[model samples]
Target chain A: MNIFNYELKINLKSSLYYLLGMIALTSLYLTFFPSFSKDTSAFINLLEGFPPEFQNAFGIDLKNILSIMGFYAFILFYILLISSIQGMNLGVSILSKEERDKTADFLMTKPVTRSKILISKLGASITIVLITNLLFYLVSYMSINLIIEDTFSFKVFTLLHLSVFLVEMIFLSIGFFIGVFLKKVKSTISISLAVVFSFFAIGAFAVNASDDKMRYLTPFKYFDTNYILKNGTYELSYLVVGIVLIILCLVGSYFIYVNKDIDSV
Target chain B: MASNIIEMKNLTKYYGKARGIIDITFNIKEGEIFGFIGPNGAGKSTTIRTLLNLIHPTSGESTIFGLDTTKYPAKIAEEVGYIPSEIFYYDNMKVKELLKYSASFYKKDSKKRMAELVDIMELDVNRKIRDLSLGNKKKVSIIQGLMHEPRLVILDEPTSGLDPLMQQRFFDLIMEENKKGTTVLFSSHILNEVQKISTRVGIVKEGKLIKLEDMNTLREKTYKRVLIESSTPIDDNYFNIKGTKDFKTVDDKLSFLYSGDINLLTNKLSTLKVHDLLIEDPDLEDIFMHYYVREE
Candidate 1:
């Protein structure tokens, strides 16, 4: 309990910052929707000028761009990118900071198992992500109503938010695994940016028409906002794959961290 | 006759073929201040870390307080306080908070002891750890380690950052703790620091325990640095005796470390046409240098 509390306390301030950033970014984007809807046709006509492949790669769906949920999903693509970077940064830095700061000797010498330490840190990261997401959901949901008069389906709007949470979890677990497997992480932000951006880039640029299997390679494509907004539910196949990846990364991280030797600084 | 508090039987660790500690076996008895002496990278930290289960042993086994070290590290850690050579804490935290966090790990209430240690070390608990100087950080490490009041304390080169006055106080504190039945494992390359408090000493070289001796017996062996300036060149066998080694004649001056009887050495020195003679008790440095050189 002390370990969990200590971990949570230390990580609390940054989490609040992420929450504020999410609320501010989404609220600011939502305010522009009223004027943008007045010029919807002009915007759609300009988007249609680009080839279909370019639209598909960039997740620009013309059919739903005018609707509030559709526009929300469109904005979600950018939000997801930022959320993942936050998740990955939190994951890697939380566990690796002990070794990076050369405080492993102090913590590892305490009367607690390594599993306890890992779990406490994991709990802290999950709590931070959950709190950020919950507050984000409330503020953004209100903004959609406050900024635009269009009646958005509460269910589809919800499915979109749930998808973001799942994708963030997958990234967080992968970050934790990398943090444990690598002996040292020199710069958490650079590594997070490099990894998150590569996956984001892959999702943006690499859409092979013949083989749709490429979607499995990048977490960004796991939840198609178009599919969620239309079908009112997550695609079962990709959802299962995301959950499996999370479990595997977390389990592997646990086993590796438990047995790893903490050498002197 | 004290029972062994820590027993290592042929413990070994290899970091993927780079030697860490090799077949090192020794025992530290209860209520003993056992000094682990070695130069840097000579496996002192490796041996201590293995015992603490910071690194798993590649082979062999060790028991602390009659429990297997690897199998029961958390349990062993409950009654152990370790002051690492380098002190690192959460830089953002104030000294008081970090100390509280460290104390919360053990089942025992340590608030009283924590305050006592802070007072003795003259540490200001209000200061943030990042703002502290290197020596002040050392003080924090000491206070945190001892506040829990563990049965055993393991320190690896613990006094490097401390000034002489603080070092004396630290030793006094350890001695005070020792009087109350705490066993201490003090590892340092500095011989004088170890000589100040250790009841027994273990000399480690490369990856093995070279020698383990009682402090008094080790000192009583009386290794003297005997240097004689002879008027004429001395024969190699002229001072041949049971405990004379590194016998070298450099430019008509015979020098060797003699551990034999003082009277025998004096009689031999009187027979020689010595221009000057000097026999002094060898410092711990010379004694260790002799051991290290002899091993090579």
Candidate 2:
């Protein structure tokens, strides 16, 4: 319990920064929605001029371009990118920072078990991600209400928010797996950015190709916001796959961390 | 029948193909300060870490307080305090916060001991760890290791960055702990530090325990340097006797190392007109060299 509390306290400040950064970014984009909706037809006409491949790559849907949900989904593509970066950065840095800072000897020599150490760190990361997503949902919801006077389906907005959380979970587990397997991560942010961006790039290519199998490769395509907006639920196949992947990564991380030797610096 | 506090039987560790420690076996009795001495990369830290369960042994096993080390590291660690050669802590935390965090591991309340140690070590608890100098950081490590008042304390080259005055104070602290029946296993390459307090010592070289003996026995059994000034020129074979080695004659003087009876040497000197004579105990470096050369 002490390890858990210590880890949580150490992670709290950075997590607050991530939460504020996400809120500020989402609010900045939300304020532009009211002005953009007035010129919806003009914006749709401009989007139509672009090639189909470019439109698919950027997740632009021409048929639903006039609705608020469509605009939210379009902006959400970038939101997912930023959220995944935060999750990956947190996961990788949480475990690897001890070794990078050469404090493993101090921590490992304690009376706590290795499994406890890994679990405490994992719990801290999960808590931070959950808190960030909750604040993001509340802030985005309030901003959306402030913008328009008409009614919007609360269910559709909720499904879209759940998709963001799902994608972030996949990225966070991947980052954690990398940290456990790599032993020492010198530049955590750079490695995390590279990995998150590569997945985003691959998701873009999958969009252009429109291949069903390619969707399995990138976490971004797991919960399609367009599908969520229309069907009002996540795809079962992708959701199952995402859950299995997270479980595997987390279990593997604990196993490797417990058995690994901590060499003196 | 007193039990051994620590027992390692044929313990060996290999980092892939490279040797870490091999076929090492020794036991430290309770309430004794056993010194582990070796040069750089000679596997002093490797043996200590293996006992601490920081690194898994490739073969064999070690026991602390009669419990398997690898299987029950946390249980063993509850009563053990380890101070490494290089000290590191969370840079974002203040000294008091770090110490408090370290104390939270054990089930005991170390508030009083922590305060006492802080005063004795002359540590400023309010300063952040990143703002501390190396020696000051070492002082923090000492306080953290001893604040819990553990039954066993293991230190690897613990006096590297400390000044002479601090080193003396640290030795006094360890002596105080040992007097309270705490077992100490101290590792270092410097012979003087170990010689000052150790009851028994194990010398390692090339990943093997080459010698283990009581400090007094080791000092008494090793060779002694003998120098003699004769009034007249002496024959080269005049002092030729058993246990006399490295014999050299310069002018009317003769000097050599002797490991045999001192009375026998004095008997030989009485036969000659000895102007002056000096027999001195050899330093630890000479003893270490003799062991290495003899092993080769």
User: Which candidate's lDDT is highest?
Assistant: 1
Residue ranges of candidate 1 with Cα displaced over 4 Å: A206-208, B224-285, B288-296
Candidate 1 residue B195 C-alpha distance from true site, Å: 2.3
As a TM-score, model 2 comes out at: 0.91
Please tell me how candidate 1 rates in CAPRI terms: high
Tens-digit lDDT track of model 2 for A1-265: 8877888888878878877877787778777777768887787788889999899889898865557787788878888998899889888888888888889889888888899999988888888888888888998899888876556779988888888988898888988988876656678999999999999999989887746889889999998877887888899999999999999999999888887777778
Clashes within 3 Å, all models in order: 0, 0
Error of 1 at A159 (Å): 0.9
Residue A63 displacement in candidate 1 (angstroms): 0.9
For all candidates in order, the CA lDDT equals 0.88, 0.87
Docking class of 2: medium
For residue A10, give model 1's deviation from the true position in Å. 2.4
